[model samples]
Target: MAVDQGTFRRAVARFATGVCVVTSLEGRADHAMTVNSFTSVSLEPLLVLFCVEKEARFYDAVIDSGVWGVSILNPDQRPAASWLSNRGRPLVGQLDRIPHHRGPETGVALLDGAVATMECRTTAVHEAGDHDIVIGEVVGAAVPASGPADEAGALLWHRGAYSRI
Candidate 1:
């Protein structure tokens, strides 16, 4: 039997996932989107991947820029994640309200207070259904100097809502 898209999506939603904001620069403009499909593919060479829908405005910018930043969201960043995920949100000045700093290596905006951040250069792009899987090699990374006791837990997506872990 063939599973329908709704069924597949619902089944996959049962698995909890961490949230992240992927940022890239297209000329002097910045583009960003909330993504839960981010993951690490390999460690030795430090590779990571994230999937972006073909229709997302940030998609073309990211594919063309070849460099991007990943900000692993903490619980306090839920608002930023929600804003970035909205459809038809302005393509320009999207990051203006969000607190961020430029990544040293790629110059992409990395959200402030994120649990961790990574700057990557695109190594490959693969077509998958309506989305493209972008794999990148990490050239730079950052984590706060605070101890574990002061760190905020990660923000997660579960059952269509945000949760903390």
Candidate 2:
């Protein structure tokens, strides 16, 4: 039986998660989207996972490139996340509006406002529900906001709105 939409929505929404913008380069164009489904799977081998909607325009890019950059959005970058999440919004001229640095490996745009960024290579992919779970091994990562020796920062999503902890 199908679960009620409202019930499922509320139930899942109860578990808050940090938001991120996963990005990759498609030829000369850059694509990115807001994702709250990012999670840490392991640390020994440096692994993490995030989901992509099956039909999203950037799906093929992620598959074809085999590499992706995940930027954990700081509280100030919420507007960028909301904007990029809107597909088919004429992104040709909006690239300059985003403050970013290109990843040396994939050349994907890494937002500067993020507290941390992870560059991952696709290790495994699986289908679940209507999304594809893309698991990656973190090959390189940087936490400039926290300094070379710091590992702490203000986290943005808590239970709906942005919260610092």
Report lDDT (Cα) of residue 122, candidate 2: 92
Q: Kindly list the per-residue Cα lDDT of model 2 for residues 117-155, writing each as its tens digit.
A: 988899999999889999999887888745521343444
Model 2 root-mean-square deviation:
2.7
In candidate 1, what are the lDDT values of residues 1-165, reduced to their tens digit? 999989998999999999999999989999999999999999989999999999888899999999999999999889999999999898878888999999999999999889999999999999999999999999999888896513888999998899998
What are the runs in model 1 whose C-alpha is more than 4 Å off? Answer: 147-150
TM-score per candidate, chains pooled: 0.96, 0.86
TM-score of 1: 0.96
**Each model's C-alpha lDDT?**
0.94, 0.81
Number of the top-ranking candidate, with lDDT as the measure: 1
